[model samples]
Target: MNKELEHRFVTELENNQNIVHKICTLYTNDKSSHNDLFQEITIQLWKAYPKFRGDAKFSTWMYRVALNTAITLYRKSKKRIQTQDYDSVIYKIKTDDYDDTEEQQLKLMYDAVKQLGDIDKALVFLYLEDKNYSEISETLGITEVNARVKMNRVKNKLRTILNP
Candidate 1:
């Protein structure tokens, strides 16, 4: 709202933009849709910034807001065409040092992840980000034990999707 708060919000958003980009990549299918989602998420974040009490870390709070915005908008944005290839995608689901075999496996895993439900996809994304159970729980608004249980289920689901 005010200049100081706006400056702080912009600074924080810039620093943690990767989180938003990653969410947009997973939730969107095409470049135009991805840009639209990113803009919507940024607007939502700006609108809600005034209420950010900073009780948790800025990134942590951001995860909640960003994920929520993605899930909400994704449903409304179903008109966007779902493209298959994301090679030019900005935030790819890739890990450094992945060999050819690992790269193929990663593609399979990414496809499986893309097919997942919103909460399950969020759980896997957080897990891949190396967020501990506590952080995943906090970000997803679930208890730690619930997070673990759901993660286990998501893993099993992914395994089934990948194998079959």
Candidate 2:
């Protein structure tokens, strides 16, 4: 990549690094796995950076690439050991002035979300990030209607998990 493009990619990636963090958090069960996933996602993004067209927003394109890396490539790799015990993942909530009740509730929600299938977890992550159906569809490469349907199902699933 040329200096200009490399600079652009770096600047944009710095601004949007949270997107990668959120994906890593949602997909990985522990801190080490999260770090590994983040590194893999970054490498994948860099490798594909040259092919990025400006037709879509950089963040949107980043979401597509990041989600694809997390969902498809990362999972298939032999290095990842999938874990089902969501409670093993630690959520670092700064406890100074934090309400215990609220923190526990948030932990419960995260635990519930962690139990979802990979695709459902991605949908929930996008929804929680306030992405509209269109953006979710574009990121996941699913139809808008399918995104809505899937989101509704995920929401219902979460409700059941929380309430049951």
Candidate 3:
């Protein structure tokens, strides 16, 4: 990439690195996996940066690229391991600021979220981030109607998991 483009990409990426972190946290269960996925997403973003047309917000474009990377490129090499009901593996990175009750509830929610399939998890993540139907549709390449429907289903699924 040329200097101007590189500078722009770095500045934007630095400013919006939280998008990458959120995606990584949702997709990876452990620190090693999280770091690996983060690195992978960053590489993919760098490669695709030249194609970004700036027709959308930089953060919006970053969401699409990061979600695509998490869903498609990053995968665990080991056979999946069975985990406990409230797995702490994923929550290890969380700060101790949350009291025990809050932490337990959060862990349960995270565990429930982990049960969702990749695409559904992406939808849930977007919903939790307060992304509207249009933004979620654009990011995931679904129609707005489909995004709304899918988000409803995801919400229902989460409720079932949390309540059951």
Candidate 4:
């Protein structure tokens, strides 16, 4: 890639690296698997970079590529298991910028989100990141109405976990 395009790609990745990590974590249970998924998604994004047009937001295009990569990539393990404690997870996710309570809530929420099916997890991840239904639909190749309905169900499931 040329210097300008390389710089643009780096800028985009830096801006949205969290989204990539979030998707990888949502889809993979273990750290090794998460890393693998992250690498795979990065490869897909880098490969798809040449085709990205400037019409949509860079993040929007990223979501499309990342979601597509997540859905289609296959790993040998499919079982969902919870091995990390919420407190530990919270501590790990915490940054200097994040409040303690927000970190705790995010960790708790991530634990509950792990129980959701892959597609539902995708919806919740997108929703939490403030992506609109239209954007979620486009990213996941689902209808907007379906995105809304699935998100409502995911929310209810989350509420049950939090309240239980």
Q: What's the lDDT for all of these models? A: 0.89, 0.86, 0.85, 0.81
lDDT leader: 1
TM-score of each: 0.84, 0.84, 0.84, 0.75
Q: How many residue pairs clash per model?
A: 0, 0, 0, 0
lDDT (10s digit) by residue, model 2, range 1-164: 68999999899999999999998877766778788989998999999999998888898899888888888855575466656556555576676886689868877888899889888988998888999999889888899999999989999999999999
Between candidates 1 and 4, name the one with more favorable TM-score.
1
Worst 10 residues of 4 by lDDT: 73-82
Q: Alpha carbon lDDT of residue 161, candidate 3?
A: 94
What is model 1's C-alpha RMSD? 4.7
What's the distance in Å from true for residue 37, model 3?
0.4
Off by over 4 Å in 1: 78-104
lDDT of 3 by residue, 1-164 (tens): 69999999999999999889988878777777788899999999999999999999999999999988898854453356734334443456646775578768877887898788888988888888898889999989999999989888999999999988
